[model samples]
Target: MRYTSAIGVTTAITAGLTACGGPASNGDGAQESGGGASGTIEAGLSYPLSTGFDPMITSGATPYAANMHIFEGLVDLDPATLVARPALATGMPKKINATTYRATLREGATFHDGSAVTADDVVFSFERVLDAKNASLMAQFVPFLDTVKAVDTSTVEFRLKYAFALFPSRISVVRIVPKKIVGADAKAFDAKPVGSGPYRFVSAVREDKIVMEKYEKYNGPHPAKAQKMVWHLMSDPSARVSALQSGRVQAIEDVPYIDMKGFTGKNKVESVQSFGLLFLMFNCKDKRFADKRVRQALHYALDTEKLIKTALLGNAEPATGYVPATHPDYSKAATVYTHDVAKAKKLLADAGVKDLSFTLMLTDTGWVKDIAPLIKESWAAAGIDAKLDIAQSPAQYAKVDKGTFDVLAAPGDPSVFGNDADLLLRWFYYGFWPEKRYGWTGSSAYKKTRSLLDRAASAADENKRKELWSQVTDLVAEEAALYPVLHRKLPTAWTTDTLTGFEPLPTTGLSFVDVGRA
Candidate 1:
């Protein structure tokens, strides 16, 4: 990562009361980033596999905060404001055509190396994601972009195949990576990064920690107050919590599901709710999975109630729908799966399946390890012996796109999912992961799901959109393409209440931007 600094604003929104209970747009253009998060606080982040601190390979919840130091987009969504405002771009995208748009470059923006942030830089960044050679994780994030071109020094345009209502939100996530940000010649830049954000990269000590200092050029209202922020890589959630207790660190993240209760306001420990879904994704085109009965059986075999009780310890809400069971559009009809071994067996037998077996890819980090074992046990309890196929993340995610695996045990964080099912549908049922039903197995069921996604993404009416999503959700649950497990509250168990600003988000990983220590 090339260490660079440039002054720019991520969307700053006006705060409103509606955002209190959950994630909502802030009505105020600029509000206090909350509490006195102006000091250094050692924080913990459980990165998804292989997300090497590099934007291209990086995954999970880091980009919103971590990547803010290395790179940023022309605009960012102020979760509170819910407005897509200028960060890298000077303002909102300039709509140039029915299927195309343009964005003006920010004024006086320069990278850490002091190079001007030009239209070429923006185009280069977009090209990096589109280049199939790089195999960037961001590819899955924006599978629909047909192409991106820099029209001039001050303008960049996007040509899309379809009109995405949340196109701006999608743009909000593509952090601007300086040219040569990755690959063989990327050594120098990777060691340090240059970006137009509020922070500057100071040092990255391998797997131990990455440090950054606040940018003096920052013009935003709530500039980073701390002298420096540090992210320590800790694997064991308990180990991380102990560090917090011992004062080795101010905060720890990816709190174990069972560990949530240990935190309370008495200790100044707060548990915020995040938009995340634990699910069992099935590759529909695979021969073993061609049988809907087999897929449906996989869904029925899970003892989610016991999994939450014994494994999750009330840390999560047993998933019953397509999106997080808590999302506004989630439907009751979507919450279909329950532990019915008889039903699972019947489904399997009906599909003429016996001596059934499949590989469950997992990872050491994230829910793959903790929850995978429970799921494996749950599956075993139903007499389906499954093998564990584990890989280092976010690379493991790449396999999902190819449609190579049988069953994928993963969670859909809203950060990646957006506020809608757009990303989910793209990566799962409707898109090409494992295999698209575009071929032999392709059927009306596939069309129905894809149509739901298309309608959901294009819907202009909010109420109608909500109803459409409810139907989309119920349809997926009924199909059991990807078994939705539970909705989770952001879990953070700490040793003390020294740090603040740990609002539960719709994504994964940990961040230090709005977090400060007493």
Candidate 2:
């Protein structure tokens, strides 16, 4: 696909997975532009458009980033700090009773369409998300919420099914949208989103690019600094680098680990440790993996240090616990697996496994592909025969979700939704993956893990909650149904001289909230 620049010159963008090199071009075209400083900001992302802009169900990288600009929740998370602060609400929601809370809307707030943002809009937003038929990915996060209703024109109240201590942080999962527009045509609304945010949706070309112009009437704490923003969906890593080098784009994300040192001077690069993890998941229904000993054995066999150093080029840190050490609430799990082939072999033998064999399914993520061979080699050393089946995330998960695979090695960053322990842990264990996908929900261990997680979620005492969370972490680590191997750092590159206030995020996607072109 090609992009037509402001002057009607078409710049060809290469559209396949290929080696990273200089930016693609058909001849001399527009180059070296910064969005925040002088003109429209042109940015590049490594992934293409996968989902829509609806905050309740959207999970794609490109769409999620667009939602960051096009929508605002009651309590919004700072893209950099991951801290929850007031956005649409006047301040943090006040706890009225054990199971009820109230928040007042900011005065003079209006949607991009110039319609007033009322308590009804907020109620509709949460109702749609909480509705089970909608299958909202966010519904799982707010299990405690029973109903949201308008108290008056500006005030809104929430009644929880049970007391939830992390209600403030959990409420950040869904962004408020206009009821009239969305209720008219949900599909059309997804394509053309309307929100009270820094930027308003202009157009989207699917896997090519998405455009957003500044919402002139935005009255939020963070207003649009740039007049316009163009997000180029370049799945090819080389294209992203080339766009950065040619100045076609001022900033780019998911910088290739091998090219980190090549950036210099005006082009600055930074890699922040993120909760994004490469995890190993087992199909617990399979007899070979039913025994906890066998699962622990496989984890012990892998030389994770060697794998990270060689395949990841030392860009990742081993998962010391379920959550990365960078997480504020990090806990050290009881059973920490290090490279010990003898221990792995012993565990396998003790489980009455003479010759272990399994098919290892993995996603086609570039980094995972590089690490796949090392995984097979490590398992082979422990006398386990492993076969690899590599495919995209959706395809791989489809097979895993169907109970067709023996093991899965994939990279997932649920931190994009919310960075708290309860949300992060529940993502894999509480609702879907453990029970329906991994077949572990029927087990006693899975039940215990769920109990501990729920106990942690509702605990009023912070210390007691931490202790329960730690217990859950230790049980999951010992069971080894689905656990992280390493928490990788996210590397983002930008022209320091041009783009100001642009900070790299620990989660997925880039933030241009306070950014301005220098």
Candidate 3:
């Protein structure tokens, strides 16, 4: 990819990755120019918080950065194959044993600086995730870490604490960093990133945007053709859509559900099948939710049909389980939440509950507020009185983390997990608490659920593991640890509808590398 500046010259910022470096390019046919055409595509991203612009605490921002030009892992999933393909890695590593594997580098692949990507760089990147100080939310998934040994300048090997079938895919999220520049503070890397991705960090103009110029000498499987990508930070959904339409911005993520249909006439819209699960979470510790009958009754009271039709504003899909319906293990019925006021009332009456009062803490952004009042009314009809507590950005997370409220209408898109229900139950469905971070611990259900999860994890046979996991899933559903609600779709758009190579990232969102000039 090459570029020459054909338009206005605003500012140019360049940073280096741990392994690779060289003279950065910008625009078409120009040195220090980024890839792609001159036409601007202002992208609008929404978040409760800035994700600190850092990976350690950036639960929401990381995905956007991952998509933009800021980061890259050793390998990336191929859109066409949905298989891990070499990005920084020279070639795919062959498993040497149950817990060991090795791979080589492409020899000349370097950070944006031109420093060659080597085995040591890969090792350093993986180890960083395990650092206790980082407490990467990603740590919960990739836990079995022994060591990343650099066999040689180009070759790296992974020695795991235990055998994992999905190790390669897991590495897809471990964005490699230059061990040299990371300094004592990992948080510092956020402001000054050293990544080998197509884009390099320029300057994070606080509260506005993060700018990146293209690397002129990127030697990867699929580097960005665009010279630069400008990520505009805007939290308002309506404003975002307006910006895109009015040409203030070229692209926006998570278009309002209702406006999706209206955009069909002119704008391009793409929906990627996602691994995300957006569901209502029950406070397992809540007295009313503690009863199985009461939980089931509450589930029955939710009219998913009405919610999807009206409350969701058209950006909704019926959820079967924690995993998206498209996921292979998602075998449950999506029709679990039927509208049955009579049945719901009877179950609540039998549970000996007079009236349930709890606050539904949901985000104020997007369609949440649009739906809160409706859901409150649904529960009220079932003899459950609920109040609405809406918060924005950090305040929402603070409350949820502290467990300061009850009956959270939480929704999330956990990156793709292994085909088992272990991570699903352990990190999410089990409910969250202050000290527990994310687990069923401190709850009455912890001991029993954890034991079953252990058995499921340790089971060697594939069929046996599925059976155990199936039992665990059913058990959690029955316990109402988190009421299964709906699966979310990753709304995306391409330069053209005929654009080829676009594929869904295994982690939940869409990958842009697969896209090409139409």
Candidate 4:
């Protein structure tokens, strides 16, 4: 497959992957000449276009990253820092009462289609996510939201069921979308998104590349610095490194740990401590795992420290709590899963379990694949027989959603959406994950977790909210029904000579909002 632009630049898209490495061109025949703010910024992305561009339901890491450039919430988070700031809105929403808040859109803000962004667009955005039938992935994040109404063409009002102290930062979960485009054909809008953002969506091919151009009409705070961006979807870590080293692209994300030292002086490589994690989940409905002791046993059996050293090349930290230590709200869990083979065996024996054997389903992510063998070995040493089932994320999740899986070890980082403790914990524990995927909703532990999260969400006092969150973290940690195994570092590589204002993100994907080619 090939894409030829109006400017006569032809991009060859190979089957299952795109070709990497060539001189960086400004989508024209000539190479980028000067360190001006107006050239093409090519990047090597570590994930393919697995999901759509719609902010409401898009869950894939790649698309979520793209949306950071292509859309704006009333408030948006700084990609480099997780700090929330006004984007589409003139400023942060102003509180009117205990449960009411209001915001005025930025004057003259226009969508990618050149339509003036109105309060109605903001209302539509929240309504769709709030509507249960849409099944928006963001619905779980804003459970406190009751209604969103347009006060006028510029002003919008929000009524929350309860006073959520984190409401200002939390609302960043829902990105504002053009109502006319989405309401006309949601499926079409999902594929080709249009938003009032700095960068306009140009084109995307599933396994090839995603292209975006600077939205000239954008009146946002962070306007696009580059004229265009070409994100080559290179899932292979080696390919990503090669693209950066060869100067085919200015930056590359998910740099392999083994190749970090090689890029030392030639390119800047930094590994940021991210909330991203590899988690172990159990089918609590299964009689064998219905016992909390069995779940605890499985968690205790793993040699996490050794796994980090061997599989991750010491790039990850063993899970001490639900969130990583870097998180502001992080608290040490009551029961941290340290390696204890004897304790594991005792717990299994206490449950009267003998010859425990099950299929351990895990994703085929680069790092997770490296850790799989060690997982099986650790379980085997604890007198447990385990079968390894490694597959792509979609396939593995298909079985998990259908309740056909025994156990799963997969990478999850809801911090891509928002980094709040309530938001992160509720992502897996409160909603679809516990109720549908892991089958923990029926348990007493699940009920208690729900209660705790609800109370914490409504707590107006910051200290009280943190106290409540700590209790919930301790509860989830001890249960081990579905909990993190380790929080890994996210490594990114970029060249200073070719790009300016590039910062490695502490989250999953790379960001280029204010970045420009040098």
Candidate 5:
């Protein structure tokens, strides 16, 4: 109340191994049992360990999911609802003034290493993120924060540069970490994280699995329900389905759309419409895409509805705005890219463009691969020649960050961090994506977006904030530089009889904070 708040590989062999309850190989190529000690929640995760477990810098889906269990922010979002709630703190930070906040640590809260969680730890956690040298992924989310000071051992004070209406919930972006541990060896802390959460980091094998045990010292609202958790990094879709069907794992995330019906009655399979989306981003500096009309034409060219039906099996909604229609700050954009091949061609012709041809780079995620051909077909229908270059996420992003790619189709869900419209919008438009990734910082439109977002962030009136956000929504939509093609449904599968209190999340990844083995 206070919170008020992939791979496939040798399909037959992997499936057969999991089905036989045999040991699975981790990223280290070491054999480990899919089944762990009693009271362990075994899950098959679709992603491999792409990043480290440090909450401040972790961007990979799998590691981010792991951090949800291994760490805690003073105010954490409810795993299922995305509503802000007190975790390490006693309650929501008390608003001291228009630009200041104060929060008290929960009594007796201790880090997994048995160190008491102090205000200094909280201050350190924030300063590191605020410091540009750390290059934390979270710094962009808290641009209004001016400083964080330890008011006392148990109390932390936050001073913001301006009044931010969402400060209470937005601070959930930074997870509290022990100063002694992280300050001693930052690199070691990244590899093996320590936090004051329900779970303690036991071990992690890059590609194979991540093991965590319930922290006996944890005394929080959501204490661990299971003694241990073993997350199998099974990038292959078949391995995940097989692991779930064979009872080798109690739950699995990213259930392949094609395999949804197969687990109908046998397992509880649910597809929750999520903010997660497949977005199309372009290199604004490219000579061909330098014109905004060229960007708009590409969006109009795509038959999104047909792509959803064919590639996604009708499991996604065409993008009507920057955020999905289900989002709380939903506002219909000024220009929605509905299918119109004629309009696409006309826009291209008006822009004085001819023989538009470029390579469209994309990730090799199962659903993305499925839609690649359809995307190409849709563009081809509009007289555009798009060469497909599909690879794993890291490789594709490597090329993108180097500014060597033309267009990229990638899956992104910032909702996993927080669900507010400002947060979601800023994730792309405000920081790294525009400045570096897509090369849109030089555009006048980008400056306008930044101004509108800053003004909205400081707006005290809720309605006024929404109004500004809506303006941004329209502007970004019309710009069409980096926009969503469709918001896809996240499918998850689990056995109700084997695990109690398990529910599919509307965002990416799976949560088991209060879940237990039956």
Candidate 6:
């Protein structure tokens, strides 16, 4: 998709908000102002454009947030509720057999380039993702997927390697892309994506902003309700809050926990329970964290309740298991680590380790940054010295993936793909995140966990799958190589007077799929 007009503005709207104590437009032209009866919707995103918008491999916060509007999978996650709903597909795929399924595409669905979205595009999308050379992050989720083929003009068939029950839901990993446009220039396509969604890709500035306008020719269940959208990449928490307060942006995400109560009247704030969690991953290769007992000791030492109340402002719940208590498939793990300083000391003593000193690597996410000191304090109380090495997620993850860090404390939410136990479990344990990333594959525990997860995925019976999942959960909890400390509630602030159909997402980032300016 080709776009014109380079509208530039300052980083933040500080002056206008300082002049007036309430919501008032900064009048920074169309560049920063948005959301009236017939105005563009400017959203203050909490992340910069770190990764380019390639649907298959894009994982960066800003790019992934933008792709939610610019592309649609055969099945798409509902913005408000993360439930899988039909997007490009006419409806949910029909199960033909244990290994085969068919999806009928919605007719007249065209890419932003005005080319018809054919079954060929669907087949190509999945094939590209399935190809090993592309290094798609979605490849691991579809290990069961044997092949995808275009049976007809409007129908696509999926052949699984085994009997996988979550086939319908798992297909959302691959978003459909135009074959001609992408095939011609893959690099250019990544920079500027073209897909059949409500919003068309206009232009994107690396760390400044991303611009998109409603695709008038779009035909889908959740069509764009606004004329245009501009996502201001405000990585700073104060800048985001200022943008919303100044009326320079209609909505803002990652609302600070302390500031939630101050939002009143026309400025609304809501903290929706999200599957997003502050996870702790240990490098199994490190002799220090190699012992499961030491890992368990560290978890037991953490005062999770205190952390949530003080660090997170009670906008989170201690992780009981892999899935939160709110989840439908929630199962309390057999091993529950409930803050016991005495138990932690005893475990460390039993393991024959004294005064543990290790460097803790963390990302620069605002909430995570807030909780980092608390974590160190918890460790200090437990007679452990944890030196902090704070850096951005990409940099921190580079250290994590290379086994350069002792322990990694970062935030992740894969529930946007699917909320199922298998999908959620596989995200950390099954993919490159486990083997190449954290070096957890060497252990017999990893082998057993993988075996149990595989059996669970293939098990036809729901009860059997649950049992297998629980078994894997117990084993992982016992291993303690990686686990969640708490599942956080995503806080979002929006102007109630100017935006309609605006809802806080249970996942990270905001969605304007069906939202409009009042």
Q: Model 2 Cα RMSD, Å?
A: 6.6
Each candidate structure's count of clashing pairs: 36, 5, 42, 0, 5, 0
| lDDT (Cα, tens digit) per residue for candidate 2, span 362-455 | 8887888999999999999989999999987777766775689999998888888788899999988887878777789789998999999988
Query: Model 2's lDDT to the true fold?
Result: 0.84
Model 1 C-alpha lDDT versus the unseen true structure: 0.61
lDDT of each: 0.61, 0.84, 0.58, 0.85, 0.85, 0.82
Give the lDDT of residue 410 in candidate 5.
84
Lowest-sum lDDT 10-residue window in model 4: 1-10
Task: Show the lowest summed lDDT stretch of 10 residues, model 1.
Answer: 1-10
lDDT of 1 by residue, 1-518 (tens): 00110001111111110111212212111232433334554666654122234555444354335665556687765543234566888677877765688898877776655667778878887778778777665666676588888887878989987766667667775777666444335534544556767666765543456566666665443356554566776767787766666566656767766555566553435545555667776766677887778888988898888767766666677766665555555567644788899999999999999888989886445554667777888889788999998766444455654556778776555344245556654555654432441131366666787778778776657776677767767776676766567776666544444545544434555544444444
- Superior candidate under lDDT, 2 versus 6: 2
lDDT per residue as tens, model 5, 1-518? 00000110111111111122223323221222322213778899987665666778777777788889999999999888899999999999999999989999999999988989999999999999999888777888999999999988999999999999999999999999999999998767877789998888877776678788778888889988777788988989999999999888889999989999999565989999989988999999898898889999999999999989988999999999988898899999999999999999999999999889999998888899999999999999999999999987767777787889999988888888799999999988987789988899988999999999999999999999999999999999999889999999999999988788898999878899888777
Give the alpha carbon lDDT tens digit for every residue of 221-243 in model 4: 89888877888889888989888
Tally clashing residue pairs in candidate 4. 0
Cα lDDT, model 5, residue 65: 86
Best-to-worst order by lDDT is 4, 5, 2, 6, 1, 3
lDDT of 4 at 176: 94
In candidate 3, what are the lDDT values of residues 1-518, reduced to their tens digit?
A: 00001011112222322113322222122222235433223456654223334443345443344433556666665542445677777666678987888877776777765777778877877777777666555566666667888898988888878776556666665667777767565556655666777666665543355455556567777666555545565767787777767655545667666666656544676555555544566655567676767777877888776776886655557666556666655656323666788888988888887777778787665666777788888888888888888876356556655556576675554443233355655565433331232224565565666667667655557677666666666666666656556665556543333233544343432334534323
Q: Where is the poorest 10-residue window by lDDT in model 6?
A: 1-10
Checking candidate 2 for backbone clashes, the offending pairs are: 23-242, 32-247, 35-41, 36-517, 37-517
Ten-residue segment with the worst summed lDDT in candidate 3?
Answer: 1-10
